[model samples]
Target chain A: MLTKRIIPCLDIKDGRTVKGTNFVSLKDAGDPVELARLYSEQGADELVFLDITATHDRRKTFAELVEKIAREISIPFTVGGGISTVEDVQVLLKAGADKVSVNTAAVKEPELIRTLAEKFGSQCIVLAIDANLVNSEWKVFTTGGRHATDINLFDWAKQGEALGAGEILFTAMTRDGTKDGFDLEANKRLSESLRIPIIASGGAGNMNHFTEVFQQANVDAALAASVFHYGAIGIQELKKELQRQKINVRI
Target chain B: MSNRKINIAIIDYGAGNVKSVQFALERIGFSGVLTDDITTIEQADKVIFPGVGEARSAMQALKDKGLDTEIPNLKQDVLGICLGMQLMCDYSEEGGTEGMGIFPGKAKKFPVPLKIPHVGWNQISKLKTELFQQVNEASFGYFVHSFYVPLSEWTVAQTDYSFPFSAALAKDNFYGCQFHPEKSSLVGEQILRNFLAL
Candidate 1:
């Protein structure tokens, strides 16, 4: 049976994890590689590293980070942010990433999804959609949620799947960084519609939020940043709770 | 069990996540060269065939790189991952394509009422080979595939998604698995290390 996955996202800038990450593990957790190892030990099914720095120099640093992280951990690693071309995907993959998540570029060039799928296989392609509630309708956002597009959330998700995107990661802009909970209604719509796996991202406040998303939205995976990174919720503790609730976690 | 260096070549058909496989090797203290260079593959102590594309195109890729003819004859220990495992079989129902026939069997799509691509971590049991050394019975492995090889004589391990299917196949020096050992975490690393030891 396909069990639901719990993934912790590490937002990286200049090869370092950002967003209030304490300097506790300079020897073990301060470094992105060490932090990834810690998460793996905590029973994270997969890990996502979002490259917040888009500069050329940072790209090189990010590649190096990918290598270091891969050498340390054996779980599936996905690198995203500022990835706009096939070359970008190739660079990250060559550096040891298992998958590359596309967002802004995917919105601009829908065909980019098909090309990536054909060249690298759909399994390696993840379409990350940042959706904002515009006039009560979910609209796609770009440039880190500063702008909205005409692309409707449902239409774009199905198109992405048809275009060969193996997985869809939907981040609810309305709830991003709010620490409230996942947008259950939005997640439910996408999960029920898509044949492929759906990853529910953004607005994870506490342990109950994860349990709710898994139970109500039926997301194949739940991704959180601060809850995991800031240690607001320990991955092992959350997974153990989910298992106790009969959530069928890897733990 | 001296730590003498082993030359490993990862057969790259311009497909699959070969870098992940290479990194997995490096984690276990082995460095693998990712190349389609026929000589590099031929001379290596071991070869790992990795793939993610469909059967017909994957077959075409191997043929274009002259691997279709060379792989079946290699005397060194060879391992196949995901689509690579499927292609090592006799035939595949996908695109009605023929495989390398290294192990006589066929890969087919999962039937109805079941998810198409069996994605995520699932357990494998009935270990029939030593390549599973250090791996616990019913240990989970990362898998992402739309097609799977039906149970056959060459199958060494089985996993249940909707029903029982061949998770790993072994015959002589050739080994194949539908799961990505590189993405399967520690137990997966153990399996890869065991393969390298062989």
Candidate 2:
């Protein structure tokens, strides 16, 4: 059986790990490499490093950080934030990052997805959609959920899959940082509509929240930042609990 | 463990990321030389052929470097990962491409009702061969692929998603893993170490 994954997201800024509340107001997590090693040792299924403050000047530094993390950690990890061009992805993968996620650039130039999938295979391309529920509709957002687009969340995800995105990481901006729970209705719909794996992000508060996302939404994976970063939920304990609850988690 | 100064070569034909494989080796205290040179690959004590892009392009890259013929002739322990494993087979349904015919099997697209590019952690059980030594049955290995080689005589281990497929294949001196042992955490690290020990 393919087990549901629990991912701890590390928001990178200036080569250090930080997390933001709803994409604003950052909190210091720790050193990227040390935090990554600890998470992998603690049984995190995978790790994600998002260069939240990605800029042209910081690209080399971010790639260096990625290289450092990859050199030390054995688990698979994805790097993202401001990834627009093929060269950007090439540099990161060459630095030993297993996969690279694309969010803002993908929405602007949808062909970027096809190009990346053709160049590096779909397995290395992750389409991350940061969306907000507005007027009872999930509208896609870019620039770390600051800007909105007219595209519907489900439709864009389907198109992304067709364009050769291996996985979809959907983050509900409205529910993020609230610790309410995953947006089950949106996640379930996306999973049902697409053949690619869906990663439910945001609104993860406790162990039961993960259980709800996997059990009710049936997503392939769940990703959170503060919950795992602040020691609110231990990965091993959560996996054990999910296993006890009849959810097939990697334990 | 064998105290051998193993010379490892990672065949790089520009198909995809070979750095991860090199990093995985580094984590286990070994360094793999990245080369597309026929002589370098032929001379290594252990060889790793890794690919991540389309099968047709990967095959073309192998042929361009004249590795299509040399890889099958190597007598040392050779391991293929992902698309490299598919290229070791007789044929691939992807892009209607033919393979190197080193292993007797065909890479076929996964059946309907199952997602393409079956990504994330899955168990590899019914283990066989030294490549899986000290690795527990049903141990999870990270996977990300749309095509799979069905059960065959060369199958050393199996994984189930849509159905039981070849998770690892071994025949003579050649070994292949559909899962990315380089990215599969400790279980995958153990598998790599086993191959190195061989």
Candidate 3:
């Protein structure tokens, strides 16, 4: 049976792990490579590294950080933030990143998704959408959820699938940093609508929240940052809780 | 050319991503080339058929290049990955297409309520052949597809989804895996390494 995955996302800036509230007011956490190794030991199904800083100085450091993390970890890892061309995807995959997450670049040029998928295979491409509910409609946001696009969440997901994206990582900006719970309603709608596997991100306070997302939304995986980073919830305890709830999880 | 460098030709029938397959082979210290030329493909020490699209379309692409017949006639050891493996079967229910008929089975859809595409990693047990000699029965590999080949004598390994399904098939000179070894991490790499040693 296919088990629901538990992923801990690491936000990297200047070669160090950082966490912020509502995606702002960043504070240094620790070394990216050490943190990645720890997560792998703790039974993380996968890891996501997002380069929070878009500056020129930070870009070089991000590549170095990715190389270092790739050397230390054995599991599959995804690198996102500022990926724009097919060559970029190639370079990252060559550097040992299993998948590349595309956001603003994919939205601007939807054909890039097809091109990258064609060259590297759909399984290597992940379409990350940051959406926020505005006036009861989910609107797509990009550039780390600072800019809103005209594309609707549901329609964009279908388009991404058609473009050969292997999986969709949907992040609810409205619920991010809230710790209330996952946006179950949004995740449920997306899961029912998309043919590909969906990973629910944002708003996970405790183990039960993970259970609610998996049971209510039926997502393939749940992704969280602060909850796991701030020592609020351990990955093992959460998986145990999910297993107790009869959700299929790999021990 | 000495036998030390075993040139592995990966058939590119315009069906799937060939780079990752090439990358995996190279990562395992094996010489691999992606080509559609008949002479180069036939002359290679080993051959790999990798596909990722619809069965009918992939067969059409192979037929257009006349590789539909050339592939089955190859005397060298050949391995098929994912859709490539399905194309080696007698036929596929996907897009109402017939395959190369290298194996005696038909690929069909999984029972409903189990989802169409059986995506993600699952464990393989009841293994056979030296290809899986070092790999444990509990080893897991990544998979993503809607259709699967039914159990038969050719099936050397089995994985459970809605039920226990064929994970690896072997017959004569042909070998096939429904899962993608290139994306399946260390265990997948071991499978490829074993194939190379064969």
Score chain A of each prediction against the true chain A by TM-score and list the results.
0.96, 0.95, 0.94
Q: Could you give candidate 1's per-residue lDDT for residues B81-187 as a string of tens digits?
A: 99999999989998898899998889998886565567788888898888898788888989999889888888899998878999999999999989999889888
Off by over 4 Å in 1: A26-30
> Model 3 off-target regions past 4 Å?
A11-42, A49-79, A82-100, A105-125, A149-152, A158-165, A226-241, B1-46, B53-68, B92-98, B108-116
The DockQ for candidate 2, computed on C-alphas, is 0.80
Q: Score the docking of each candidate (DockQ).
A: 0.63, 0.80, 0.18
Candidate 1 C-alpha lDDT tens digits along A28-48: 454788888888988999999
| Segments in model 2 whose C-alpha atoms lie over 4 Å from true places | A20-29
User: In lDDT terms, which candidate is top?
Assistant: 2
**What TM-score, computed on C-alpha atoms, does each candidate reach?**
0.95, 0.97, 0.76
The TM-score of chain B in candidate 1 is: 0.97
- Model 3 per-residue lDDT tens digits across residues B121-154: 7888889997797899868777877789988999
Cα deviation at B162, candidate 1, in Å, is 1.6
Q: Looking at every candidate separately, what fraction of the true A–B Cα contacts under 8 Å does it contain? A: 0.54, 0.79, 0.13
Model 1 chain A lDDT-worst window of ten: A21-30
**lDDT of residue A41 for candidate 3:** 71
